[model samples]
Target: MLQDVKSYLGRCFAIKDLGDAAYIFGIKIYRDRSRWLIGLCQSVYNEKILKRYHMENFKRGSIPMQDKLRLSKSQSASTPDELKRMQNVPYASAVGSIMYVVRCTRPDVALAQNITSQFQHNLGDIKRELRVSCYSNAGYLTDADDLKSQTGYVFVLNGGAVDRKSDKKSIFATSSAEAEYIVAFDASNEAV
Candidate 1:
């Protein structure tokens, strides 16, 4: 019967019996006899990560990075020199979230998470100071302290920075023209 076949296959593949298929491989499963669809979303994974990392009680953020969020380098971080130690950061929670979704073909966050993991330790030391014209020239001129969220966002098109950032810029601009001038120069140099 179909039940026997399902059991055999499930055992062969090492699947847990959830009774009803609610999810699989990070995808939320829904079925209809006449219609079919499968979607990969962050909902369940988000909750799992929150709970595992003890952030489950945090007010669910509407945006990934808050406008007022800030992380400064003043706090001394424990930078492990060994690669093995790097894997054991108390906060590997950020990396775990990326892996589950990445293998499922969600490519949007690939660059962001990769960059985050690289700076796993000594994240504080990497911060740059404010009010420097050089930062503006390089297209990073916001408060560096506020840019420490575990995600990255880039909005570019045709190989240009429509909006791109690894972290926040280090300084606020006094005027639009000054900001644009700096951005233009940076992009031109990058293209070359």
Candidate 2:
């Protein structure tokens, strides 16, 4: 069937069969015919980014960021000397690089990515399984600058993350419960 499709396409269009795709847009592809599983990885891209930022020598951590960590504009370069020093740091560039990874195959880091993204001016894992499951969470008043709540959720299908999001709520939540409700609502919307 695959060959027939390829032949038909070849007859109609100027196309060449590249055999199996090993990499697309820098994401490595792995195939397990016995298990009928295809996996994607970006470790090489990740390493290049780390080396670009001189972070290849840094220690690895289980989680991207510390729990309860709050970042705001207040933490940005405040003094003239601090601003001058920050001028050399590619804060926005670094964040943009990692964000591509988050969008592709790193839903676990979504929350951390979202938090750090709020300060682009300042700048900053997974399992496989079968059943589909979703998780929703929110941080009440987590944004120190705006006092806005943070919402996050991930959808896992067949042991892999299919969709995820992390962003600050547009409106302020007066209570943690409210924040939770907001996240739940957002997740429900995404699920549908």
Instruction: Please report the candidate that would top TM-score against the real structure.
Output: 2
| Model 1, C-alpha of 172: deviation from truth (Å) | 43
Cα RMSD (Å) per model? 15.6, 16.5
How many clashes (backbone N, Cα, C below 3 Å) per candidate?
A: 5, 2
**Cα distance off (Å), candidate 2, residue 33:** 1.7
Task: Report the lDDT tens digits of candidate 1 across residue range 146-188.
Answer: 5322222344433333444443334455555555655655545
The C-alpha stretches of model 1 lying farther than 4 A from their native spots are 1-21, 31-37, 61-89, 125-192
lDDT score of residue 160 within candidate 1? 35
Error of 1 at 72 (Å): 12
Query: Across residues 1-192, which tens digit of lDDT does each residue of candidate 2 receive?
Result: 988999899899999777899999999999999999999999999999999999999755342244356566766777788778888888779888989999998887888777777876743101222455789999999989999998999987645577789998899898999999999998998876
Candidate lDDT scores, in order, read 0.52, 0.81
Which pairs of residues clash in candidate 2, taking residues 3 or more apart in a chain or in different chains? Answer: 129-158, 129-159
Give the per-residue Cα lDDT of candidate 2 at 122.
49
Give the candidate number with the greatest lDDT: 2
